[model samples]
Target: MSPLVADELAQWAQYIQSATGIYLDGSKGYLIETRFAPLLKEVGTTSFGELLRRTQVDTTGALRRKVVDAITTNETSFFRDNSPFELLQHKLIPDLIDTRNRSTGAVRPIPIRIWSAACSTGQEVYSIAMLFHELKVDLKRFDVRIFGTDISDRALAAASRGTFAKMEIDRGLPLDRLGRYFATDGQTYRVKDEIRAMATFRSINLLEPFTFPHKFDLVLCRNVAIYFTERDKARLFGSIARVMAPDGTLLIGSTETITGICPQFEPKRHVRSVFYSLKVNGS
Candidate 1:
């Protein structure tokens, strides 16, 4: 394939932002080249511009999906950062249950709905499921449903499989927890049925308008907004606020913030971690 020229890079950057809301400036020209090079060869395109054009005109959307899969970064692991899960295990889950018990009563099964946005390959979703088990949260007493969504179909497929290679299991997953939650299959491990049953996966574009039938008690949109532009970031969080329960909590990347971007959410701190809640008025 020929080199990706300035014009082609600009067009690709624009197209990527439009389709996936991931901003790619001129400096990221090499990224477009590096990520799309394989697709170029597979599609028999001689140049980056040709590949972009093919993707745009492909009616089946198969090529477009491939482009999305190739372009979007799926960097994730089981409990990627320790603090958020720690917060969930120590504060969020307990506090949420206490709040729900008051309204629904102790006998009724309290619903705990969670959304892990851009949940690449299901690690975060499974991590949360494992926490419920570790806490000995009675599944009969608490109806726990963890929803995981991402833009890449490839990523979602891997997530749905509930299987991981040895390297994947090594990152952030402890040995004791692994033995308890995963079934060994040669060098690979699969999440146990009990843990797998607690979560669901789907494909969703956060930049586009979306709605859910029910409001989530906790939503984790971590490490994804940095890819989007400021306007899109505001739009993204605004939409998230709508689908959140009145007393719901939102967790973003440790390095990211919604402070100036979205006024609907108010930050709350617990130990070393920070999470967001809908302001009383905002809710």
Candidate 2:
């Protein structure tokens, strides 16, 4: 891997940030050098400069997606943060059930939906499914749905399979849950059939045009939005708001909150952490 040429650097910078919301700052040179070196070699490109030119100039468009896919970071784990799930288990679900039961409407379970936007692998989606299962809650009554989407077809393809490497399974996932929900296969652990059946995976780009099939009871747009520009992030949240049911809760990453950036949500305390709840227009 030769050092990227000046024009190569600029083309890659603009191409990546425009296509994906990842803004490459100064240290990005090393990322390109280190992470994508093997990709260039695999493509039989002699230098980063040539690969960059092909991606920037290719009318074929295949090279462009491959480059973008290579650069996209897909780091995640099960129950990455535990507080929100604790709140969901102890407080939110019980209160929601009580509230719904009080209504003199249908004597049936309500539609419960969750959207994990940019759900990288199956871990987070499976984590939620495992959460419900731990509660010993029967899914026979409720219309439970979890929608996991990512821009990368490659990522979504892996996620939909519900398989994890031993390292991935060891990371943050509890032993008790693992024993119950997974089956060992050499170096890998596959999520049990029951958990895999609970969630649906699809390919979606936060930057491009797309629509949610239905309004959700909960939306977890988590750590993924930190990549977007302020304008893009605002637009992203606003579009998200269109599909968020007025009373449904949206869980963002602990580090990334809508405060100042997105004003549609009202801050509320749950499990000693701050979360944004859907707000009623002050009227």
Candidate 3:
């Protein structure tokens, strides 16, 4: 590909994101060609520039969704990084439980709410379920609700299925955990029915609104905003701040730190990964 073609693809991605709130990460033109080339060829389009022109003129909305889904990175796996899970299992959960118990006295265990934003393929959310199960908490006793949301409907549907191929099941998942939590079915593995039912998956447009039906005690939106420009990052964190409860914890990807982007949250250092606590929010 020539430099000019790459540059035009980048521009088109920027336009798509700015117009439709779906980020393309600029480096994902290969994804566009890989996924859309067939459609483009089927439609008799020859080049990326021509495809872009067709997308602009065509208001049928099919091309837009296809492009966005193709370009959206759905890279995720079970127990993605051991350290973050460790921190959640050890540090954050204990602190959150104690704080909730002290704040709300009428219950045996206080309710805990969590959101896994940009949760691709549902592994991260399942990881959380395993942690709680390991803690020996009767899931029925404590009101625990986990919401896994992604911009891609395709991924959300897969997540809702609570099933994985052998390779995908093996990736980042320990053998013992897999054996206990998943049942082998022909060529694939499926999460236990009880564990799978603990989380709900949905399609969410994060750029549209900061409104969540309910405020969460913790939000894990890691690895989702790394490619956004500085200004977009600022807007994203601002939107997150709106939906977050005061004192709620926010975990981000290891490579991403909202230090300069969001000053309202206080950085809390943990052995696994640094998390930000909402010292203040849209009050």
Candidate 4:
């Protein structure tokens, strides 16, 4: 495999950071080389530098798309973290439902929109669908819409298909829930259409302006912002706050904190997990 050239690192890193808001340090050159080696060989490029130059010259942008897809991390699994989903099942969703029920001017089919930002390969999105299924929420009475978005077109394509390998199904998903929510086909599993219908997947760059027509009731932007610089993190959470309902809930990676990043949200502890709710008056 060809190594990433020493001098090309800064140029590639800057381009990646500028395009995706994902900071790639010098140490990540090996990662870039490993990911691109196959593509480099296929495209007849002998060095990463040559490949980079070709991508720059490709005005059609196909090579650029391939480069971007290679750089974006798509690591994910169903219920990858138990705390947030547990919080959703035990507290958050129930509370939101109660609030919707109590509203005097509530419309028929209470609207429940959930956005899973950076939902790579659809695991988290499918997991949310399973959560609702387990809750036995009468879907006929509620307009529950789940949106899963990621910057990688390749990831979104896989997510939209709702298929998972046996290994992926084993990770973080309980055997019984897996049996309940998915249909086995040979060694792989596919999310059942009923659950699949509850969610939609699309390519979204969080750094870009908001394009979704409606605000969400619950937003899960987990484990993704760790890649962004502090400024990008602030912009991301700020944008999320703008599109989140005042009483809406946000779940981020367990180790991630918004204290110094975005002040629009206040951390709220629930049992073993933490979720944020938009603070009134930006407190």
Candidate 5:
């Protein structure tokens, strides 16, 4: 395969941003090369520019999907970054339950909805489901629905399978929890049916327009936004704000803040975590 040149890099960067809202600058030429090398071979393209041209002209859109699958980062692990889950267990869940109870006293089958945006490979969704199981929350009394969405179809397909390799399970997943929540499938671990049934996965592009029939009580749009430009980041968060319940909690990457980016959300702190909630007035 021919090396990725400056012109090809610029073209790919623009195309990626237009299609997926992931901003890649001149520095990412190597990333484009490395990620697309295998793809070029599979597609029988001789160079990055050839692959780009094929993707553009492929009316079936299969190549475009492949490009998206290759370019989007799907790196994730079970309970990756411990603090957000901690916040969910210690503060967010309790607060949500209390608010629900106060509004509708002793309502049976209380509704709890969560959206894990960019939920790569389903680890985060299952992790949250496991946390709820560990908390001993009565599934019979809660209308719990955890929806996981990502732009990559490959990632969503893997997520829907709820199967993980041993190496993946070893990352941030404890042995005891693993035994309780997963069933042995030869060399891999499959999330038990009970845990698997609690979540659903779909393909969604956060940079594009979308709507849910119901608003989420907790929204986890973490880490993925760092790849977007400032304007796109604002657009993404602003869209997230509209789909969140009035008192819903938003957990971003530990290093991220929406302080000036989206003023509709105000920061709140727990023991070691920071979460956001909508201001008194809606955005």
Candidate 6:
């Protein structure tokens, strides 16, 4: 693979940022080449500049979609990081339920909506649903909804299918939970309809405007912000804050931070893990 010219690298950086808020620099030139090489060959282009030109002139936007999908990192596993789920199971869900129940006087079913931002292939969404099952929360008393959104159409399609390969199931998924929530067919496992029905998957770009129908009680934007520019990170979290309940919980990557990115969220640590909540003034 040849190195991308400085001009071509800058062009791609702008295209990627404009399309997905992902900032690519010279250091990532090899990544761009490796990810887009097949697409470039399939499109019969010999140069990155030619590929960019073709994508720009593509009226159907097919080339652009291919490029974006190829570039977006869809790396994830079921319960990829253990601490977050542990926190959710042992503390967050219980506390939230209690808070909501008290506010409503147990008069109506509690609504607990969660958004798995940059949710790749729906593992995290289903994982959250599985937790509810594990907790044996009464569905009649709670109207729970989980939404998994990602930038890749292919990833969303797989997520919507609710099927996972053996390796995918084995990674970060507990065997007991697997048997309880999934129906096995040979080596592959399919999430049971009950769990699948609790969640929805959509193709969403974090850089764009959000129009969710309801504000979320919990939002997980994990392990996905390292690719964004500082300016874009501020914009992304600002929009997220707007769609969050005043007391909603926000979870970013274990290594990621909103310290200087979004001021509305303040970090709270539970044991070894950390989560964020809306900062109340004068506290």
lDDT of each: 0.93, 0.80, 0.78, 0.89, 0.91, 0.88
C-alpha lDDT of candidate 6 relative to the true structure:
0.88
TM-score, candidate 3, is 0.88
Q: Candidate 4 lDDT, tens digit per residue, 1-283?
A: 5667778888889888888899988888887888888789888977888888898899998888898899988899888878788899999888888888788887888889999999999999989888888888889888899999998989999999998998888889898988898898688899999999999888888999976788899999998999999999999999999999889999999889998679999989878898898999974
Mark the 10 consecutive residues where model 2 has the least summed lDDT.
98-107
**Residue pairs clashing, model 2:** none
Off by over 4 Å in 4: none
Off by over 4 Å in 2: 56-61, 101-109
Q: What is the overall TM-score of model 2 with all chains considered together?
A: 0.91
* lDDT, model 1, position 230: 94
Per-residue lDDT for 40-141 in model 6, tens only? 789887789889899999999898888888999999999878989999999988888878877844556778899999998999999999988888888888
Best by lDDT: 1
List where candidate 6 sits over 4 angstroms from the true fold: 1-3, 105-107, 281-283
Candidates sorted by TM-score, best first: 1, 5, 4, 6, 2, 3
Residue 258 in candidate 1, Cα distance off native in Å: 0.8
- Candidate 5: regions farther than 4 A off: 105-108
Tens-digit per-residue lDDT, 10-128, candidate 5: 99999999999999988989889888988988988878999999999999999999999999999999988998988888778877767776774656788899999999899999999
lDDT of prediction 3: 0.78
- After superposition, which runs of candidate 3 have C-alpha atoms over 4 Å from their true positions? 1-11, 19-31, 42-44, 57-60, 105-110, 280-283
Single out the weakest 10-residue window by summed lDDT for candidate 5.
98-107
Best by TM-score: 1
TM-score of each: 0.98, 0.91, 0.88, 0.97, 0.97, 0.95
